[model samples]
Target: MLVSKKIPWVIKYRPRKIDELVNQDDAKALVKAWLRSWESGKPEKKAALFYGPPGSGKTSMVEAICREYGYQLVEMNASDYRRASDIERVAKVASLQKGLFASKRLILLDEVDGVSGVADEGAIEAILDLIETTKNPVVMTANDPWDVRLRPVRDKSLLVEFKRLTKTEVLNLLKKICLNEKLICDEEALKFIAEKSEGDLRSAINDLEAVAEGAGKITLDLVKQILRARDRVLEPFEVVRNILRSNYVWQAKQNASQTDLAPDELMQWINENLPLQITDPEDLWRAYEALSKADVYMGRIVKSGSWDLLAYATELMSAGVALSIVNDVKSKYRWVKYQFPSKIRLMTQTKEARALRDTIAELIGRQVHASKQKVINYVLPYVRIIFDNNPEMAAKIAVGLNLTDSMVRYLTQRNADAVLNYVRELRKAISEEVKASKPSKTSSGTSPPTKGKGKSTQTKEKEGRGLDAFFKKT
Candidate 1:
C-alpha cells in the first residue's frame, strides 16, 4: 500500500492530545477522564466535544487520543463533508465496522457546532441518531459550543473547553520553535509574537515561521516590521478616543478622518463616543453644536446634489468635535457603540408621508385642472378653514384628493382635532375644485396657455378679470 503523504506544517504541528496540548489543564483533565473510562473497558462515553477559540489544538488532541489508543481514524469536517446522505452513509458504515486494521475505529466530527438550518438539519439528526446507537466513540470539535441546536449534543457529550493561549505559553512555544528551527531571536521578538497572536498559538507559530523564513538572526526591528505590516487597521474607536484627548482641535480633527474609516461612519463613531470623551457640560454643548452643523450640511448635500460640499461637513464634524473636549488629559477608553440619529429616522418617516401626500395632490390636481404644486402650496394650506366651515365640502375634498387619514392628520398640523378637521376640508376643497374646473363645452374649445408674448397677454387678461370680479363682488 502507498504511504500517506506527509502532512503540511500547519497540520503536522497540530497538538494531538489533551496531554500534548499546551495551557489547558481543565480540558486535559476532562479528556483524561473520558479516556480512562475507555481504558477501563467500561461502556465508553458516547461523545466527547472539544470547544474553544481557533488554533487552540482542540482537533489535534482528539486525533492524538485516537492514535495513542490504536483506534482507526475517520475524520469529517462539517463545513465541507456535510450532507444527510453522506452523514447517513458514513454512520451506516461506521456502525457496522468491527474495526479498521485490527484497531477500533474512532469517528472525528469537526465543527459540529456549525450544524444548522434545513441543509444541515438531516446531518444533525443523523449525528444525534449515531450518538444514541453507534458503538465507536465520537469526538467533535467546535469554536463555539453555545449554539442552541448544539445544546442536545453538548448535554449528551463530555464537554472540554480550550482557552486562548496565555502570553507565557505563546512565548514559550515561539521560543521552542525558534530553537528547533536554529533561528536566533530576542525576547522582544518573542513578546511581539505573543502579543500579536492574542492567545492564538497557531497564529503565533505561523507568524514565527513567516518572520524566520530565510533569516540570519531575528531582531526586534525585523519583528516590528513584520508585525506592523500584518497588523489590522486601527479601530475608529481608538482614533476617536485619541482625538478627544488631543489639545489642538485641528490635530484631533485631522487624525479623525486620517483613519481609514468612511466619513459618515466616522461621524457616527465620534457622535456615539463624544459624551464618553467630553464629560464637561459646556464642552458637550459645543461638541453637539458642531455635530448639529455637520448634520445640517449633510442634509443639504443630500437634498441639493452637491457632493463636493461633503468635505466641509466632514471637517466641521471632526474638527468642531475635537474642539468640544475641555481637557487634553490622555486616558484609556472603553469601546462605545454608535447609534443612528433619531431625527434621521423621523425625517425618513416624514419623507414617506410627503410622497404619499404628493401622490394624492397629483391626483387631485388632475381632477381640479390645477397644477400639483399649486394644490400643495395654495389649496391644502386652507384645508383647516374648510373643515370647520363645511364638513360636507371637506369630505368631498378628501374623496377627490385621495387623502389617507394619516396623511390628512399629518398635513393638518400636529394635533388630532386639527388634523381631522383639515382633512375633511381639504377633501371638500379638492372635490369642489375638480367640479368647478371640469371644462364646460365652451371652455373645452379654449387653447392651452402659452409662454413669452402670449403669457404676458394672458397674465394681463387674468389680472383685469380678477380686478373686475373683486370690484363687482364688493
Candidate 2:
C-alpha cells in the first residue's frame, strides 16, 4: 500500500508575515530597525545574532521578515557553514549588486553553535569576515550564543534574545492548527499536548498532527495513548519527571533511555533534584546511596575501560535512584522545581579563569624547569606577588618567561598595561645597546670577524643566551 505524502504542519503553517510571529516584539523591533539602518548605506552592526531555546522563532522570524519585506533570502544550515571556502563564496555572491533589478539579499547562517573540532576556529573567522564585508544583511541563529567560541561574533553583532513561548501561546497556536485542519480536537487534548511541549510551538503542532492524522476525533485518552514522550527528545526536566513518575522498573528505565545526556551527566541532574524531590531522611539517603553506587560503577568503567558495564551504571543511576522512594511514594511525584546541576554551573563559571591561570603556570614552568601543575602549586604564588608589587621587576620576569598579553593581564589585572609599558621600554633599551655592541663596517667597507649568515645566526643566539642568563641572575 502506498501512502500519499503530505506537508508537515510545522512547515505548512510557518509564520509568513511579521504579525504571525508569536512573541518577541523586542527582537522583531530590533531586527526591523537593523534592516532599515542597512538601507541608509551603513548600520551600527552589520549582523544580528538571534539566540534562545529551540522553536523560539529565531530562524522562522528571519524567513518571515524576508518573505514579507521583499529581500531575497540565502540560507545555510549547520553542515554548509563548516567550510570556510563555502562561507567566503556565499559572502562574495551576496556582495554582488549586478543591476538595478537586483533585490537586496539577506544571508542566514542557522545553528552557528553546532560547529566544532579542528575547523571550528577557521569557521568562526570565516563568519567574522563574512560579517565585516558582506553587503547583504547577515544574520546568525543559535540555541545558545554564549558558547565561548561564538564570543567573537556575539561582540560584533546586535544581540536579540528570543524567549520560550508560554503554555497559553502554545495552546493558542495548536487550536489555530486544529481549526485550519478542520480536525475535531478536545480542549483537554490540546492542553495536554501543550503542557508536554513545554514552550516549543513546532513540537506542539507536530504532536497535534501525530494524534489527529487518521483519528476523526482527538480526545484526552487518545492523545495520552499515542502522544508519548518517546515521540520526541525530552528535556532534562522532562527526563527526570518521567523517570520518577514511573510505576514499573522498565518504565523508569524506558525514560532514561530516551534522553541525549550521558549517564554521568544524567546522574548529576537526578542527584541535584533528589533532595528537593524527596523530603524523608530515609528516602533521601536511599536515593543518594543508589547514586553513589552508580558513581562507583562509572569510576570503575573509567579505570578499566569496561564500557560493557554502562548499562548497570545507567540502571543504578536512573531506575535505582528513582525507585528509592519506596516508603513515601507521594514525595516522588511532588511538584518541586528542578535545578541545573550546581557543580557543572560552578565549573562553567570558572573555566575561562582556570584556563588562563594554567596558561600562566605553563609559561613560568618552562622558564623555571618544572611541571605545569608543580608551578601552579608552588611557584605561581610568588610570581603573582611580584606582578602585584613591582612593575619593573615584573616586566623583567615577563620578558624572561615570554608571557603573552593575556597572561600578563591575568597576573596584573588593571596594572597589565603599566607592566607591559615597562617591558617595552626594557626591550627598546636592550635593542639600542645591542645595536651599539654590533661590529661596525671597517674603513674598507668589510665586516669584522664575520662568517656570513653563520656568524649572524651565532651572534643572535649568543645575545639570546646572554639575556636569559642576565634575567635569571636579576
Strongest candidate by TM-score? 2
- Pick out the ten consecutive residues of candidate 2 with the lowest summed lDDT: 445-454
Give lDDT tens digits, candidate 1, residues 201-289. Answer: 87788787778767858888998887677654567766776666543434455566557866666677777767765566766887899
lDDT (C-alpha) at residue 322 in model 2: 69
Candidate 1 ranges with C-alpha deviation above 4 Å: 1-8, 16-18, 231-474
Candidate 2: Cα lDDT at 318: 77
**What is candidate 1's CA lDDT for residue 2?**
27
TM-score of 2: 0.51
Worst 10 residues of 1 by lDDT: 325-334
Candidate RMSDs in Å, in order, are 21.2, 28.8
State the lDDT of candidate 2 residue by residue for 1-474, as single tens digits.
Answer: 133238788888899987789988998899888888988887999889998878879888998988877778888876576567777786556655422354788888887775432133467888888888777888888877887778999999999999999999999998888888788989999999999888988888888888987897999999998876436668998898887766445557879987888888888888888888888797788879988999999999988999999999988887787667655666766798999999778878989888989887875665567999999999988888888889888888776555667788888876788899988877776655545655473232243432321224543344344364445445
lDDT of each: 0.67, 0.78
Q: Candidate 1, after superposition: displacement of residue 121 in Å?
A: 2.1
